[model samples]
Target: MHSSTLFITLTTALGLVSAAPTDKTYNPTKTSAASRTTHTVIAGRGGRLIFDPDNVVAEVGSIVEFHFNPLNHSVVESSFDTPCQPKDADSFFSGFFPVREGQSDEVFQIEVKDTRPIWFYCAQNNNAHCQSGMTGVINQNFDRQEFSLRAHKELAAEVEGPSGVQGGIQGGWRIPNPNPLGGF
Candidate 1:
């Protein structure tokens, strides 16, 4: 009876341990070179920063490309603080810059590694670009709500000068006044 009870307890403990979830952080340091997929997101297509297809799906370590807008834009990690962490496909090309009129910062590419819901935003307006609903996501379960939140949050932070150059009412994010616009 004692031996049986001990075995049962040990089995239960092991079961519980295996069921526990692991902790994953939004890391922007380490980079892994995996098979890449050129996922292009076009900006300034219809007077808005749009990701065309709206939905992008890829395996881990794929290289996602974000074609910037002629409206002058930047990329950043989806967060309220505009961390400018760059959540595209890879973390190696992390940066924040203002593209010239009718120009962009080249093909923004990064690697999607972790299977976490990565977010991003435009580092221009008061997240005007993002707040205006110009945001996107990678990995994790995504539909609509999740994309808006993650994209806008990071855009907000980016606009706050992720590169120290605020739009200041000129070439910034086109924030739809009065309300936030979706499908951007």
Candidate 2:
């Protein structure tokens, strides 16, 4: 059962990753032709990618991406702001589950029309990163939506967490490294 979930997760990742890291900047997104690709962020490697720009607006054929940092997480396109519990098994998100961690899963190329509102969250308890607001937008195209995202921050205000974790940083239960690595 574990391997099966991993397989489905890997299949979902390949569907989002783009060719290369497009222009990494704010105020102005990549206008190049290859910008159609996107990176779907997930848990693993480290923490996770927070809303650096906090929010972004994309056109019809824009490609976004999500990468794993130093945390164990997944970008499940379903609902439930929690983790593992997939609820968007409908037509759009069904069979489109891609998650990666510890290693590269797959690349997910955006194939939606305009305004793709994908809600992703980390399924890590004891750390409860998502409950602490670890979500962002890919190629969302709307003014009102940007304003709506503001709630994600307050959404976790009641969450008993964030002792040593930063806002954009990942916060989840993890085993301490027995061996100390020289460098990060």
| Among all candidates shown, the one with the greatest TM-score | 1
Q: Across residues 21-101, which tens digit of lDDT does each residue of candidate 2 receive?
A: 678665766566554543333334343434344355656665444433343444434232322233343312212223332
Q: Model 1, 1-184: lDDT tens per residue?
A: 6998888798897885354566976669989865556565665555576555445676776766655545666655543334433432322322343544443534566667767666555555544565555555666364555445454544443454333322232211332121112222
lDDT of each: 0.51, 0.41
Highest lDDT against the true fold, candidate = 1
lDDT of candidate model 1 versus the reference: 0.51
Model 1: worst 10 consecutive residues (lDDT sum): 171-180
Model 2 alpha-carbon drift over 4 Å, by segment: 1-54, 78-87, 91-110, 139-142, 145-147, 156-184
Prediction RMSDs, each to the true structure: 17.1, 22.1
Give me candidate 1's TM-score against the actual structure: 0.49
| Model 2 residue-pair collision total | 38
Q: Where does candidate 1 stray beyond 4 Å?
A: 1-35, 79-105, 142-184
RMSD of 2: 22.1
